[model samples]
Target: MSKSYKKHPYLKESSQHTKYGKKFANRKVRKSEETLQHKDYKKQYCSWEISEYKFYMSEQEVINEFFASRNEEYHWMKKFKTLKEALTWWKKTYLRK
Candidate 1:
């Protein structure tokens, strides 16, 4: 019947897409809120756990911070003798994309 066509055809599919879009937007908002909260909490409380990690302007620390968790990429980091070399490698590997 005409009623069934209007009631069911593409109606469920469109509603599902809308729900998924809303969920994705909500997750993005929650992530941004979490980042803001973390920054605020860090500023309010000087925890030793956060202070334990020292800031260093060295190649090894840069490599560890940026590349070490990326599996195969970090291996190349170990081979680089200087920060310039590492940076050049990073630019070549990442910037082209």
Candidate 2:
């Protein structure tokens, strides 16, 4: 007597099934990794570059530029507690003048 084997329905061969299974397996592996740390490092590096550029400007230059472009309605300029703060605002807001 020959032994008869029962085949599982889920194991049926189909091109679409094989393609979907491969894609699902690849997606699972791709999602299981750290990405935030790299992104944070990139953001920090960008911020550092901006600060370095701002710091490169001389204090006198910042002050001169600030007063040259001071706006009467922008009262926030008075609230700046430090020269650096005022200078930063000035560079961003009024340096074009």
Pick the TM-score winner. Answer: 1
Computed on alpha carbons, the lDDT of every model, listed in order, comes to: 0.44, 0.46
Q: Local error of candidate 2 at 52, Å?
A: 55
Clashing pairs in 2: none
Stretches of candidate 2 exceeding 4 Å from the true structure = 7-13, 16-18, 34-97
Best by lDDT: 2
> What would the per-residue lDDT of candidate 2 be over residues 6-92, giving only the tens digit for each residue?
322112233443465445544554565545454443432332222111123444766765565465546544566567888666455
TM-score, every prediction:
0.24, 0.23
Candidate 1: residue 65 lDDT (0-100)? 43
- Root-mean-square deviation of every model: 21.3, 27.9
TM-score of 2: 0.23
Model 1 — which ten-residue stretch has the worst lDDT?
3-12
Mind giving the per-residue lDDT tens digits that candidate 1 earns over 1-97?
Answer: 2211122111112333245544554455556544555346444334432222222233355567445534564564567666677766644433322
Question: Cα lDDT of model 2 overall?
Answer: 0.46
User: By how many angstroms RMSD does model 1 differ from the true structure?
Assistant: 21.3
